[model samples]
Target: MAEEIKVIVFGLAHEEYGIEVDKVRTIERMMPITRVPKTLAFIKGVINLRGVVLPVIDLRGRFGLPESDATDSSRIIIVAVNDLEVGFIVDSANDVIDINTDSIELPPEVVGGIKAKYLRGVAKIGGSRLLIMLNLSEVLNKNEIIQLEEQEV
Candidate 1:
């Protein structure tokens, strides 16, 4: 009733982003991925996590940002999408915060050149910090999700 919800904060391309915490499964350090041929450019490969094989996408690549070599802070954020779980690589994830829902504003046509469909909203935090909220479903759009499922078949 505080008009607030918790989010898992992460970074991609030096910009901040957030996702509803409930959708996140886990966060892991960068790991080895097996290349899957003929897939989308953003789909780096697949990672065998524990006993589950999950597709991993580089958020930067998906967002059409310049690729950078992985650093110590690189991370994989596993998130549940529809009936499958996928992993997304980010620069890092270090914060869990409660952001007031009322503070969120409709996303502009573009943010740093990222497509508007990929965004859920934009929120101002701490009077100066801006956080980009992502619509996971849109980020992994229906077409992409379908392709991923087909690859599994």
Candidate 2:
């Protein structure tokens, strides 16, 4: 039997993307983000999640996709990488599915305008569905993580 891994699937610009469930802390509805000055264009800002203030990034902007106003379906997926927790603002977070490890293939140079460097792999699921796996470490690089940490305090 092929090894199976669970993933949290989210939508961005009508495309489906996934992140390993182990890396996800929680998924929250769209919340108010307090914008900070001088941050990158994609860095939406920080949001007070429960008691912890987490930096939020607009995935659409990060991936250079067309932006849409947040609707009730919008979500913030909190993921932890290298001990830093950050929230990704997505169009919607609507599924959790398991995929066979053997089904994952190396990403092409670019997928939906996002560079392969920020992608883990691509997986085919549900017969005709394609899921793009996110490489969180690359999406939030060491330097970017440091910048996010500074946004905390």
Candidate 3:
């Protein structure tokens, strides 16, 4: 796939990451998320988005990173994976970038301090711009999603 692919870029900590743009449904600013008890720490909670409840996962917590205070730039990236829509809390939801497949290289066990297993690849753009491509399947495949789907709240 040497053709250009669109990706939605976001920030977490001091690094940048990207997800397939087609998978993204929308981006919303920080919003109230009702916490769910007895759930994983990464599963922050769920939010009622336009009459539809979406499970929200804290990306930092999911990646085992230290939590940073949520800022105004913080956003919830709504994406559809496995026919289920969920929200991923990120430091910020930036722009949509076009990356040529040739610029992407296999993740080297670790990228931007996050495990490679959670990444699909790394894109080197413009010589110094590194965009870590996230593996949505791996990031959202935890059994918690199943639990969240069963939950009404």
Alpha-carbon TM-score of each model against the true structure: 0.92, 0.91, 0.91
Q: Give the root-mean-square deviation of each candidate in angstroms.
A: 3.1, 3.5, 3.6
Clashes of 3: 0
Where is the poorest 10-residue window by lDDT in model 3?
144-153
Local accuracy of candidate 3 as per-residue lDDT tens digits, 52-139: 9999999998898999878999999999988879999999988998999999999999765688889999999899989999989888
lDDT winner between candidates 2 and 3: 2
Which portions of model 1 miss their true places by more than 4 Å?
144-153
Overall lDDT per candidate, in order of appearance: 0.91, 0.91, 0.89
Task: Residues 1-153, candidate 1: write the lDDT tens digits.
Answer: 448989999999989999999999999999999999877777899999999999999999889898888889999999996876989999999799999998899999999889888999998898999999999988878686577658756
lDDT: which is higher, 1 or 3? Answer: 1
Candidate 3 local lDDT, residue 136: 90
Measured with C-alpha atoms, the lDDT of residue 41 in candidate 3 is 75
Q: Where is model 3 more than 4 Å wrong at Cα?
A: 143-153
